[model samples]
Target: MRIGILGSGNVAKSLSRGFVARGDEVRLGTRTGSKAQLAAWIAEQHLAIAQGTLEGVTGWAEAIVLAMRGMANPETVRAAGEPAFRGKVVIDATNPLVWRADGFPSLGLPEPESAGARLQKDLPGAKVVKAFNTIGHAHMVRPQFANPPTMFICGDDPTAKTWVTELLRDFGWSSIVDVGGIERSRLLESLCVLWITCGMRLENWNIAMRLEQRI
Candidate 1:
C-alpha cells in the first residue's frame, strides 16, 4: 500500500520508517520539499519520496496519514485540495489539544466532538478513521512493553478500520481494540490529554494504556 503522511515531525518520521520497513511505499508531505535533515534521513533509510505539498504526496498514495496538529487539519485539507482527499482512507492520528489556562492541558474541540469527527465532517466524501492518537510517537513503532499494548481505533468505515488494524499489526501491535465509529473520536482525543497528565505527574513517559482480555 502506498501511504502519504502529512507533517515532517517525529510522528511522521517514525510512521514513514515503519511503513518503509513493512515494504510499503511511503511519501512524506511537508512545507518544504528539501529540508536537509529530513531529506538525509529519508535517503539514509532509503524510504519513499518526500514532497513539498499534500497534493503531491496524496496523488502518489492509496491512503493518507493525517499527522499534522489537530488545529491545523483544515489548512492541511485546503493545502491538499479537498477534492483530492475524497473517497480515500484517511488515517487520522491527530489529537485535539488546546493551549489553555485550564487546570491542565485540554482539547480544542467542542464538548461532544473530536478532531477525527471534524475531519470526517469537513471531508464528507473521504473515509476518516481515527487511530494512533492516544499513544505517544515514541511508542508508535514496534511497541514492546513486556505485554502487548492495546491500540484503540475508531471509524465510520469498517473497511478503513480493518486496513488500519492490519497496518497496526504489521507495526507490532498485538492487541487491537475497536472503539466504534467516528463519533468515538472525541473520547480518543481526550485520552491524549489524560495520558499526558499522567505521564507528567507520574514522570512515566514510558507508560501507556493497555486493554486486558481473557477467555
Candidate 2:
C-alpha cells in the first residue's frame, strides 16, 4: 500500500521508514517544498521517493496519514485540497495540544466534539481512523517491549479500522483494541497528555503501555 504521511516531524520520519522497510511505498508531506532531508532519508533507506508537497504526496498515495498537529489538521487538509482525501482512509495521529497563556496544555477542540470529530465532519467522505496518537514517536516504529503493546484505534468505518489495525500489526503492535466509533477519539487524544506527563514525571518507565485482557 502507498501511504502518504503529512508531517515533517519525528512521527512522520519514523513511520515513513517503518512502512518503507515493510515494503510499502511511503511518501511524506511537508508544507515547505523542500527535499533535502527527504533525499538523505531515501538514500539511507534505499527508497526512491521520500518527501513531497502536500498535494503531491496525497495524490500519489492510496492511503493518507494525517500525522500533523491537531490544530493544523484543518489547514493541512485545506492546503492539500479536501478532494484529495475523499473516500480515502485517513489514519489520524494527532493530538489537541494548545499552548496556554500560563504555559500549559489546553484543548484545541471545544467540548462534545473532538479534534478527530471535527476532522471527520470537515472531510465529509474521508474515513478517519484515530490511531498512533497515544504513543511516542520513538516507540511507534517496531516497538520492542517485553510484551507487545496495544494500539487503540477508533473510526466510524469498520473496514478502515481493520486496515489500520493490520498496519499497526506490521509496525509490531500485536494487540489492537477497537475502542468503538469516532467519538472515542476524544479519550484517545487526551491519553497523549497523560502518557506524556507520566513519561516526564516518572524516572523508571520508558515509553510503554500494555492493554491487558483479564477475561
Candidate 3:
C-alpha cells in the first residue's frame, strides 16, 4: 500500500521507515517542501520515500497518516484540502497536547474534545481511525516487551477500522483493539497524556502498556 504521512516530525519519520522496510511505498508530507532529513532517512533505511507538501502527498498515496502536531488545528487540515483526502482511510496518530505554564501537557480541545473528532468533522469524506497515539514513535514499530503491547484504534467506519488494524498488524502490532467509534478518541488521546506522564516520572521511555486478556 502507498501511504502518505503528513508531518516532518519523529512520528512521520518512524512510520515512513517502518512501512518502507515492510515493502510499502511511502510519501511524507510537511508544510515545508524541504527534503534534507527525509533523504537521510531513505538512505538509512535503504529504501526510497517521496517527500512533498501535505497536499501533494494526500493525492499521491492510497492511505494518509495524520502525523502532525495537534496545535496546527483547522488551518493545517484546511491546507491539505478535502479533495485530497476524500474517500481515503486516514490513520490519525495525533493528540491535542498543549504545554501549560506549569510545564505539563494538556488537551487543547474544548468540546467534541479530541484531535480525531475534529479531523472527522472537517474531513467528513475521510475515514479517520485513531491509533498509535498512546505510545512513543520510537516504539511504534517492532516493539519488544515482556508482552506485546496493545494498540487501541477507533473510527466511525468499521471497514476502515479493519483496514487500519491490518496495517497495524503488518507494522508488528500483534494486539490491535478496535475500541468502538471516533468518539472514543477523547479517551485515547488522554491515554497518550498518561503515557507521557508515566515516562516523565519513571525516567524511561521504554515502558509500555499491554492489555492482558483471559481468552
lDDT of each: 0.86, 0.84, 0.87
| Candidate 3 local lDDT, residue 136 | 94
User: Candidates sorted by TM-score, descending order?
Assistant: 3, 1, 2
How does model 1 fare in lDDT?
A: 0.86
Which residue runs of candidate 2 sit more than 4 Å off their true CA positions? 44-46, 100-104, 203-205
lDDT of 2: 0.84
Residue-by-residue lDDT tens digits, candidate 1, 1-215:
88899988888998888888898888888765557888888788766665567888877788999999888998888888877888899999998787767556799877897889889998998899998888889899898698877889999999888888988988999888999999999888988898888987988888788988788
Candidates sorted by lDDT, best first: 3, 1, 2
Q: Which candidate is the best by TM-score?
A: 3
Model 3 poorest ten-residue lDDT run: 33-42
RMSD of each: 1.7, 1.9, 1.4
lDDT by residue (tens digit), candidate 3, 1-215: 88999998899988887888888998888888567887787778776887888788888889999988886757778888888889999999999898888776778887657899889989999999999999999999888888899999899999999888887888889988888989999989988988988888888999787788998
Which of candidates 1 and 3 is the stronger one according to TM-score?
Answer: 3
- How well does candidate 1 match the true structure in TM-score terms? 0.93
Query: For residue 201, what is the lDDT in candidate 3?
Result: 82
Which lDDT tens digits does candidate 2 get at residues 37-73? 7677668767655678999898888999888888888
Clashes of 2: 0
